[model samples]
Target chain A: MSTQIEQQETETEADEETEPEVESPGERRRAQRDERQAIEEAQRETEEASLDDENTITLKVFRYDPEVEGKQEPRFDDFRVPFHKGMTVLDALIYARDHYDSSLTFRHSCRQAVCGSDALFVNGKQRLGCKTQMSELDDPVRIEPLPHQEVVKDLVVDMEHFYDQMEAVEPYFDADETPDDKLEEQRQTRENREKVKMSTRCIWCGACMSSCNIAAGDNEYLGPAAINKAYRFAMDEREGENRKQERLRIIEQEHGVWRCQTQFSCTEVCPKDIPLTEHIQELKREAVKNNLKFW
Target chain B: MAQHYSSFDRGGRRWLFQRLTAVFLIGVLAFHFMLLHFVNHAADLTFLGTQARMSQVSYFATMWLFLVTATFHGVNGVYNALVNQGLTGSRKNAVKYLLGIAGLLLVVQGTRVSLAMTTLV
Candidate 1:
């Protein structure tokens, strides 16, 4: 009985008003229905918005420094940032530091994602701080340094290891012959670039590398980010056929593609929407294919 | 060559068995609860009462089944959970073997208790 009454009320809310004069009965009825629907949707949206606005958020930022005395141990600092229209957690961090304390440190360059800095652990997930909007964050956003690496400073991890892994993959196109015209860029088919375009989109953010559990446990493991880098160059037809075997050999190393345990963490954290695990798995298939051919 | 063993990994299989054992244990637990709380006329529990039940073939089978399933489910599930939490290399292998031995000992000891109750041994 209560359910029927509730349903009736819901229906009444759907078709409550009509702004435009309707001469025909069918059009009048539609306008009335649309008005009701718009009113109901508006009411629902307002209710949802009020619920979200009522939620006051607090951010807990981890503080640590190798040089600072008296505070040898790592600790967390808490800040309450007021939520506003289209505000992001990165904006909140900036707000906190500028308004509250100058000592709070983080690395951010080219506030846009083109530079790829400001990746950090926001609520136990690796996310690009600049790109992640704040309203989406659950109350008490717990910010920490990216896991599975030596922290050089707050939110600034040593990228030398990541660079080494990327370099190890030989991330350069190796074509034996120079083009007839040295000035002209080499012609690549549209389809060829499309196949490996996603792999090339990696900005070396290191989020995928940090999220991987296997890479954390085993230091030598060529993390997902590196393997994807290799894929970008290797899969490019422009690199030529002569280098394919060498590229395969690079990925087939003991600490290479085989070490990935496929926990799906790398895929989840990638901001560029790069399918890191799929690329890694495809490389494994390629490596195995080469091995079978050799036999 | 290792064949792909269904979608269930070692951890997933253990999880499935843990749920299965829990279901089995519920029936056994009910029987146990009824025998102790309702069937037994006296309030006190004795070794003789256990022996009397174990002496029956049906009771012996039920007890042995319950004991084996419970130990395997409980111990293996624990080991699987540990492995999922990043246990690898020799340390992971060592825990695997240690837990194997512990599980074997428990099953043997538990089976003996059931045997002593029924004379089925």
Candidate 2:
């Protein structure tokens, strides 16, 4: 009899808790319609805003930050940016950084292609961000850091090694003698300057180095950029025969021009369109020709 | 930049040799292939036919040169490939010695085989 009385008490408590609070169906429908209308109106406003200025472009940007807890895991963030005629990938990145996420990190100084600071893997090809047109790329353009490079952050690679390799070639012009007259410059023939004109256009972008399979495999290999740097001075008649011979000796090391397998990847990806393979091949021939003279 | 101590320290000699041997091999290999497969039927080969070609001093000398060049080219190509893959230090030395031995053995054994074929005449 005590157990039965406890069960009755529990039932009475359950009934009190289950009491209904009701609304009319018409009122609920009107509220739902209002919410839908508000969402549509907002969508319309966004579309009008987009139409007011320009068409929208989708950019899938690679993101990673070891310091931030949320960004520790690498992910791609999509940003819908306004597209203008002749707009470049760098411009889109800037727009996204300024309007969407201020924390987006990338290295770009001069908007012009001269800086070589913005070499990126866009659409599976190495290209300068400031030079690649948005219209030329397919929709939802994929942009990532250069391949075969250690990414310090989003779209930024550690260029220390590349700079080191370039320096290893002693890229500056070294001459044994100054002009006899203080006011006069060292003379170079028109043909010689034209020969090295493309080679001299290297902005130290590291694009050709990054694109080289040999450079990726052999750390010691003087990459196309560095070898081309050597070529610039080695071929210049103004540097004299001794300096040219020294330059050739430096590049003819085991890890120098011989390491190049004629992959043409460096030439293919060079932003300046420098003929890296041709230069390397020419150096090989020159080295061979010089060695034959000794025999 | 590091200075090469000896006249041979620069890789120019080896690189030039590789190219020169490549050009020679291309011509010799093509000639050998055309002679064996196209000019003469490969299926009709006999011991006497082989001895007949080996008995000629020019043919025998060319075959000897071919054997030497082929060994050097193949061994050097492998060494270059290994170096390109970042082989260095003791590991590179090991590959160097091993390839050298292999090439020497190949040339020695190849010469013995060539002599045996000629002696049968």
Identify the leading candidate in terms of lDDT: 2
lDDT of 1 at A159: 78
- lDDT score, candidate 2, position A147: 86
Best by TM-score: 2
TM-score of the second chain of model 1 compared to its true counterpart: 0.76
| iRMSD, per candidate, in listed order | 11.5, 3.0
Model 2 Cα lDDT, one tens digit per residue, A78-145: 98888889999999999889767899999999988898999999988889999999999998899999
Write down the lDDT of every candidate, Cα atoms only.
Answer: 0.76, 0.85
- Predict model 2's lDDT versus the native: 0.85
Worst 10 residues of 2 chain B by lDDT: B1-10
- Candidates' DockQ values? 0.02, 0.32
lDDT of 1 by residue, B1-121 (tens): 0121122211323443566799999899898878878888556778887787788888888888988887887787677555545565699789989998998999999977677677556
Q: What's the CA error at residue B112 for candidate 2, in Å? A: 0.7
